[model samples]
Target: MTNWLLRASAAGLYFFSAFSFAADDSHEQFKQAERIAWSGNYEAFQQAVAGLDHPLKPYVEMAFYKRHPRLRYETEIDHFLTIYEHTPLEWPVRDSWLSYLKRHNKKARFINYYRDTSDAELKCTYLTYQLDLGALKKPILEQVADLWTVGKSQPKACDRLFSMWSKAGYRTPELVWQRVTNAAQRGQTSLLDYLAKLLPKKEAYLAELYQEVRRDPSSAAGLYRFKQRSAKESEIAVYGVRRLIWRDPELALKAWQKMQAMFTFSKQQKDSVAYRFALALASKGHEEARFWLNKVPHERQDAKLLQWLMSNMLKEQDWEGIAVLFTGRDNLSHGQKYWLAYSYAKRGELDKANTLWREVAVERDYYGFLAAARVGVPIALNSEPLQVPQTLLNKVSQAPGFKRAKALYELERYTDARREWNYLTNTSSDDEKLAASVLAAELDWYDSTIFTLAQIGAWDYVDLRFPMAFKDLFIRYSERNRVDLAWSIAIARRESSFAPDARSSADAYGLMQLLPSTAAYVNNRNKVSKKRLFQPATNIRLGTNYLEYLKRKNEGNEILATASYNAGYHRIKRWLPDEAMPAELWIELIPYTETRDYVKNVMAYRQVYHTKLGRDGNILAAVLDMKIAK
Candidate 1:
C-alpha cells in the first residue's frame, strides 16, 4: 500500500485492540511498490513487488489496470479479475475492460461479459450493440421503451438507440404521456414540459393540468374544470385527491364526495381513493374515519388498512371492532395474535383469547414472550446451533475473496469492503455462508455478521447472531447508570449490531446510535465529556446515561422508557392512554411504525441477552405486570 493507505489502515487497526500488523521489512517493500504504482510507473511498480508474497498484492495490480486505458494484456487482467472475482479488486479491472470493449466495438464479447447494471449509459451501449447485431425482439423493444419512458433525461449515448426505437414506432404518445406523469410524480417539472410537447394539443393540456395537480393537489378542488370527466381527467382527480387527503382529510373527504358526482371512477380508482382517505382519517383520528373505512369494500381491505382499522378501534376502546376486524384472517403475526387475544379477553371470551395466546407463546419475540407470561408457559427460543465443523470453517476462511474483503476493511475502504462482503454472502453455499458469518463475527465485523445471518435466514445461531460486543464497556456504564446491563447491551445491539462506528441517517453515532447533540447534553449533565461520539466507550457511557434518564422520565416504567427511547419522550407522553390499559394494548396503539417495531425488538433482544449473560430472564413478566396509563 501507499503511505496514505498504510497510514489510513494503521489508524483503523488502532481502534481494535486485538488486531496488530507485524512490523517487518515486507511492509516497507509493499509500501514502496504501492507508491510506485500510484506514481504511474507501472514497470517499476511491478519490479518493486515481484519478490513479495502479500495479501494486498492484488491492490497493486488493480492500481495498474485501473489506470491503463487499453486492454493490451487481456489475459493478465482476466486472470486478476477471475482470482478476485467477488472481491473489491474486481471493480476497477472489470470496469476498465468493459470500457475498452465498448470503445473497440467488441460487441459480442461486450454482450457476453455484460452483467445487468443500472447505469443508463452502459445499458444504452449494451442495447445499441444488440441492435447492431440484429438481436431485436419484443423484450428488447420493451427494455428500450422502459429506458426511454423514465422521468429523467437519459445519457446522450441513449439518443441513437432512442431515435431508432422511435422510428420503429415503439415510442407512442401514450408513452410520452406516461413519462410526463412520471416526471410530475418525481417533481421533474422541466422533464414534464419537455414530454408534454410530444403530445397533441388536448393531451398536452391534460398533461399540464396533471402537473399542476401534482404541484398543488388542492387545485383539483376546482371540480368545474373536470366536468369533462374523461378517464384521464378522472385519473388526475384520483391522484390529486389521494395526496390531498393526507394534507387535509376533511377537505379531501368533501372534494371526494363532490368528485363521485362529477367523475366516473373505476373500481380500482375508487378503491385507491378510499384506501388513501380511510388511512388518512384513521391515522388523524378524524370523526369520519369509521365512515370512510366502512366505505372500503371487504375485498379491498389489505393488511395495512386492516392494521390501521384495528389501531383506530383500539384507540376508541372498541374491543368488539378489533375482534371483528381480525375475523376471517388466516395469517396473524404474533403481535396481531396477542392483540386479537386481548380483544377476545376484553369481550369476556377467555377460551378464544387463551388459545390464541398459547399459539403465540410457542414462538419467540416480544409478543411471544409477553404471551408466554400471560399463559404461564416458558418462552420458546428454539435456539439451534449451525452445525459447521471447524474444518469447513477453516477451508472457507482461507478463500482469497474473504482475505481481500478483510484487507479492504482493515484499510478502512468501507464501501469496497462491504461490496466484497455482500458478494460472498449472496453467492456462497449455505455452509460457506454460515461459516463466513462466523468468520465475520470473529473478525469483529458484527454488522456484517448480523445482517449476513439475517439474509440467509440463519436465526437459529443465536450465539453467533448476538455476540457480546463491547461487553466490558456496557457493564461498566450500565452499573454506573443503574440500568439493566442486558437491556443496555440489547439497545446497543439493536441500534447498530455492535458496529462501533455506526451512524444512522438521523445522525446518531456509534454502537448505541446517540445523536451528537444528545451525547453532548448527557456529557454536560454528568460533568463528563468525550470529544469523539463514535468511540465505543464514550457512546456506551452516554447512551446508558440517556437510558437512565428516560427511565426516570417515564417514572421507572421500562416499557414506556423503551418506547420513549425510540420515539421522543414527549411523543410517548402523548401516546399514553387516558385510562390505564394493558401493556399489550398500549404497545399495539403506538402510531409510529418504527418506534413500535423498535420497542418490540429491544424488549425481545434484552430478554435474550439476559439469558446470554446468565442474568434473570423474566423481563417480560415484569413488563406484563405493568400497565400503560396517563
Candidate 2:
C-alpha cells in the first residue's frame, strides 16, 4: 500500500507539471489570436482561435465575438453563428449575438439557435422577440405558458408570462379574472380585482360575474367577481359601511355620513363616494384608512385607485398618511425617502425629518440630500471622494430651474453651483440680480456676479437673491478644465436646458449640479476659499472636474461614468466589480432601467460633442469599444 501511494503521488506531480505547461501554451496562443482579431484579420483570427482548446478557446472566441461583423474580413454568417451557438463562450456574448440575429429578422436562425440556448433570461428575451416579430402563435404560447407555469409562484416567471401574453394581444379576461380570484383566496383580493378589469369586455360582464361570485364565494374567481361588482360606489358604500362599522366604527361613521349627504348617487356617485370617503376620513384625522379600505373590495384598488391615492397624498402634503402607507414596505426604494422627508419637514417635525435623513444618507440617497439641505441640517459628507450616492447625484443633476442650481451650490460643487447662480442672476430682473449680488460677493465670485449683472440685457425672467460669493476664482478655475466647460454647458442644457436660475425640489445648485460636499472638495483642491464655490466658474470647474474624474475612473466607460456623473460612481461601481472585462460588459448590462437609458443618452451626447468639436466622431466610439484589460 505504501509503495502504491508513493507511485501515485509521483505520477500526479508529473501530470500537474504537464497541465501547467499546456495552460501556459494555450494562454500564449489565445493572446496571439486576440492580437490578430484586433488587427481585423478575421481569417488569421479564426485560424488562431481554432488552434486553441477549452478555457483558452472560450476567452479567445469571446474576443473575436466582440469584434464581429468585420468590415474588411467577410466571414460567412452561418459559420459565425454555428461557432457562437455550439462553442463555450460566455453568456453575454452569446446573448448579444442572439439578440442581434433577432433584431435583423433572422427568425428561422433565431428559432434554431434558441433551442440550444439554456440561459433563462436570454431564452425569455428570444421568445418575447419571437412573439413580437409575429413568428409565434397559440401553440408557441402554450409551450411558453407551460414552461412558466412550472414555477407559477415565482414573480419573475409570472411577470415574463404576463408580458409575453400581453404583447401577443392575448386578452384572456377569463384567465385574468381567474388569477384575480386566486389572489383573493390568498387574502390578496385587491390584486385580484385589479387584474380583473384588464380583461376586454370586463365591464359588461362585471355585474353578472359579481352576483355569481358573491353567492358562492368559494374560489378566487368568486371573490374576484364579487370584488369587481363591489367596486361600484353603491356596492363599496354597502360593503364599506358594513366593514367599517364592524372593523372600524370611527371610519365607518365618516364614510356613511359622507355618502348619505351626496344628492345623486350613480356611476359617478361611486367615484365621488371613494373620493369623499378618503377626504372625509383624512379630514376627521382617521389617519389609518385600513377599515374603510378593507370595505373597498379587492378589484377597486387597481392602477386607477393607486394613482388617485398617491396623487392626493402628494398634492395634499399628507406626510403622516404617506408615511403610514410606505413604512416597512420594500416596494418603496430609497428614492421615495426624499418626498417622505419633505412632507415631514413641511409639517415642521424636525426630529422625524432628521431620522429619515439619516436613513437616506446611509444609502447616499439623492432625495435625502435635498431633504437634508432643505431642512438645513448638517449632514456628514462621506470622506471618500467621488464616491457619493448616484441616486442623489442623478436627482440633483436632473433638477429643473433655480432649485437645481441651489442643490448644486448646497452640495458644495462651487463652480457649477455658481454657474447656476450666475445664470439665475443674469436672467433675472435687475432688482433680483441686486438681491443675489451679496451671495456672489460672499463666495468671492465678484466677476461672475458683475458679469451676470451686465448680461441681464433685458431681464425678463423671475430671479432671486444670490447671497454666496467667490465669482472671480470660479471663472478662473473653469478656464483650467475645458472638460468642465463642456460638462457645465451640457448640464445647463440638461437642467432647465440652460434656463439658468432653474429650480427643482432636488435642490441641485448651479449648472453642474454639484452637491455641497463636491463643491467643497473643489474649493479645497483649488485652494480657493470655500465660500467661493458658489461662483459660476468655481462651480463649473468643480462640477466639470468631478465629471472628468468619473469619466477616468470608469476607464472611459462613458455609460458607467456618465451614470456616475449624473448618479454617482459608487452606486454605478456597486453594480459591477473592479474587474476590467466584466465591468465594461456589466455597464452595458446595467439593470436599473433609468441608468441603462441614461448611459445611452450620455454616450450619444458625448458623440454629439465630439462631432461639434470637429474631432473624430468615432473617437468616443473607439473609447467605448476598447477591450477591457484583464
Candidate 3:
C-alpha cells in the first residue's frame, strides 16, 4: 500500500521537493483513487478522486468513465471525448467510445467518432458500416475484393461482410480462383475447399488437382503428364517444387529438370524456385547443393540464401570455397568481414587475412574481440559518458506524457507507465531522451532505463544504462550459488528488466520469470518457506541457484545454460553438435528463434553489466574464444 501511494508523492518531490503539503496530499489522494478505481468500487473511487487538485486529475476523471457501464452512457462518453480532445486521453477515450458504438450497433456514431487506427478488426467493422450506409458501390466492392484475396481467414467480424459480398455477386469465378491460388501459395489449404465451390466448373476441377499435387508434393511428376499448360499449371509446379525440395531435394531437382523443358514458368518464378531448392539442399549439408547453386543466377541471391550458403561452407571447413564465394563483395557486414578474414587465414593467406582483421578489430562486438585477440590490439568495446543539456531536462520534466507516466508509476501500473514513457520518447530530442532515461533510472524503473538509453544509440553512459540496482541482494545470491555476478545481472535484465512483479503469458512469475512449478520445486528442495516469490531477494536467490544448476549440467557452458533456461534442458541437449564448436557459430545454428536470441543477448549484456561494475570487460575471454560444450 505504501509502495502504491508513495510513488506520486515521491515523483512530485523528484521534480520539485519544495512543494507544500496540500499539493503533496492531493497527489497522494489521486494515487489512492487509482487503486480504488481498479478494485471496481465506484462509490469509494469517486469519493477518493473528488476535489483532487493534482496533475493526475484527468486520469481520475477517465477512471470514472472506465468503471461506468460502458454502453449505458453515450452522452457522458461524448462529453468525456470533447473535454479531452487533441490530447493523448482523447485517443484512448475515442477508442473506448468506438468499441461501445460497435457493441450497440450505432453505425452513424461509430463513423462520426472514428480515427485512423491499425487494428484489423476495427477497420473491418468500419468498412462494414460503410457498406451498411449504402455508400458508393465501387469503393466498397474494391475493399471487399482486397479482403477476400488474403491467404488466411480474418476475424469473425469480417465473415458477415465477406458473406454479403459473395451473395451480391461481387465474388466472381475469376476472383475466387485467384483467391484459391493465393491461399495455396501461403499454405492456407484449409480455405481451398470453401473457395472451390465459388469457382467455375473447369477451374473447380483444376482446384482439386492443385490440392492433390499440393498434399503430396512428390506427386509433382504427374504435372508433366498434362498435354496443355497454363498459368495455373505453372503456379502448381512452383508450389510443388518449393514444398518437395525441403523433403527431398534430389527428387525436387529431377522434377525441376523436367519443368525447364516444359517452359511453363516465367523467369521470375523459375529464379525463386531454383533459389529456394538450392538453399534447402545447402541447409541439409548435401553435396548436391553445389549443383543447384551453379544454376542460380548471381542476381537471385538473397540475404538468407547467402547466410545458409556461408553456414554450409563453414560447417565443412571449406575455406577456399568461402574465399571464392565472397571475394570482392563490397557489402559485407562486420561479422561477414571477420569470417572472410578467417577464411583467408585458414587458406594460408596470412597477409590478406591480417589486412582485413585490422579493420574488423576496431568493431565493438563479438567478432571484434576475436579480431582484437588475433591482432594483439585492445578491444574497442569501451564506454563513453553522456553529454546531456540542462534545458532539455527541464522541458522533459514538464511534458504531459511524463506526468502521466509518473502518476501511473506511483499506482504500480508499470505497463501503463511504459506506454506513456514510449509516447514521450518518440517525440523527444536526444538530450530530452537522455534525461528521461536518467529519470527512469532514478524511479527504479529498470526496463525503461535499459530501453530508453538503448534508443539514444550512445554507448558511453554505461552507468545509467546498466545500474547495479539491488546490489546487495544480487551479490549475496550470486556468491551463494557460485554464479558470476555479471551473468546473474544479465539474466535478471533480460528476464524482466528487473521488474520484480513481471509476469509472462506462460505463467512465469517475478523478476527471474520462474514458472510456478519450477518455483515450487525449488522451494521444496531448498527447504525455504517464503510464499511471495515476487520479492527481489527471494527471486534472485532461486534464479541464481537454478542458473548455477544449469551451468553445471551443461558442463560449465554459459551459452548452453542460458539456452536451456529459455528453451528447456531436454530440448537444448538435442541441439548439441556431434563435436565441440565455437560458441558463436553454435549459437547461430540453434533452431529455436527465441532461445537463440536469448543466448546472444544474455552474453552481450553480461559484457555490458561487467563493464558497468568497473571490471575489465573482456568479450573474447568471456564467450568468443571458448568452445560451447557438446
| Best candidate (score: TM-score) | 1
Q: Which is the leading candidate under lDDT?
A: 1
lDDT string for model 3 (1-630, tens) is: 123124534555344232223545666787777677667676776677776667677787676666553665677678878876755667666776787788889998888878767566777788889889988766776677877777777788888888888787888867877888877666676688777777766566666667777778887767544445767777777888788999977788888888878856788898888788777877666788766765688887766666766777787788988887888787887767877988998889888998999898887665676677777787775656554454555567777788778767776777777778888888787778888876666667777877887887866566666667688899999999999999898898889888887888987878888886777666665444334667788888888988998999888877788998899889999888888888777776675557766887787678767766768746555455767655
lDDT of 1 by residue, 1-630 (tens): 223224435655222233235525545666666777778775787686686666567777787777774556677777777787756677677877788899898998788767677878888988888978989555676789889889888898899988888888898878887887788777787777777788887677776788889889888887877746787788888989999998977778789889999877889998888888888888777888888888899888887777788888887879988887777788877777888898898899999999999999888688888988888987777777555565666676767667667766776666667877887777788788888886786678888989988987888778777788887899899999999998898899899898776778898888888886688777875433333777788888899999999999999988888888788899999988788887866787677778878988998999888877866545788766678899
Which residue pairs clash in candidate 3? 384-460
Q: On a 0 to 1 TM-score scale, where does candidate 2 land against the true structure?
A: 0.26
lDDT of 2: 0.48
**What value does the lDDT take at residue 178 in candidate 1?**
80
Ranking by lDDT: 1, 3, 2
Report the C-alpha displacement of residue 37, candidate 2, in angstroms.
78
Q: For each candidate, what is the lDDT?
A: 0.80, 0.48, 0.75
Candidate 2 per-residue C-alpha lDDT over 4-59 given as tens digits, one digit per residue, 9 for 90 to 100: 22453455422112222344454566567767866766778778777765333444
RMSD of 1: 6.2
Estimate the Cα RMSD of every predicted model relative to the unseen true structure: 6.2, 24.3, 5.5
